[model samples]
Target: MPSLNVSFSDEEMEGVRAAAAAEGKSLKQYLHDLGVREMHRKRFVAGATAWADKLRGEFDEAFPEEIPPAQRGDGAAAA
Candidate 1:
């Protein structure tokens, strides 16, 4: 397994320690979990973006005659 070493001021360390204790985790475990959660969040966002792009393409194909909401003169919201 690889390791990461980070530096923090005393005040920052104290705050981190308090947070870890509040979560019933050691500082290292808290930080590790944070990293894992961030990775999962990023993957979720990427997947969602790809899905939206595909949906947009399909919507355009299905409604070629319609003007997109953004281009409407009245700036009406899409139904």
Candidate 2:
């Protein structure tokens, strides 16, 4: 795999080093984990947004208020 060169301030580098040391990981491994986590989070949000849009379209196509907020579990505790 190809590597990209990035520059950061001395303070930033120190912070990364300290964090990696605390976690018992090399700086490279720490950065790799961070990047992977962010990518995973973005992919999850994209999937959820697509599903929500599809559901909204279906809800509109059916009845506007046929599915009430309470029935949809809108923040209320389930019975």
Candidate 3:
């Protein structure tokens, strides 16, 4: 329902047209799909980052003062 106007250099326009033809799409359809995929990618990254941060916080709370395995002196010290 909405429209966007974009300009490209001659070389860039040719490259875009070539890519659309290679994918069996018109330039409009190719650009539209590219935009949709980029939107989804950004949302996925944001959600994944939030989930990782929450898990990290919980882990830190559960393991305050926990020594990493590499820093632990030896198997005997671990026991």
Q: lDDT of all predictions, in order shown?
A: 0.92, 0.85, 0.90
**Pairs clashing within candidate 3:** none
Instruction: State the lDDT at 34 in candidate 1.
Output: 87
lDDT of 2 at 27: 89
Regarding TM-score, does 1 or 2 come out ahead? 1
Q: Write the per-residue lDDT of candidate 1 for residues 7-72, one digit (tens) a residue.
A: 999999999999999999999999999899999999999999899887997888898998977798
Q: Give the poorly placed runs of model 2, Cα more than 4 Å off.
A: 57-79
Q: How close is every model to the real structure, measured as TM-score?
A: 0.68, 0.63, 0.68
Can you write out model 3's per-residue Cα lDDT over 13-46, one digit (the tens) per residue? 9999999999999999999999999999999999
What is the Cα-based lDDT of residue 64 in candidate 3? 84
Q: Roughly what TM-score does model 2 have, to 2 decimal places?
A: 0.63
Question: Candidate 3 regions off by >4 Å?
Answer: 58-79
The digit string of per-residue lDDT tens for model 2 on 1-79 reads: 9887878799999999999999999988999998999999999999998998879877777877666455876546543
lDDT of 2: 0.85
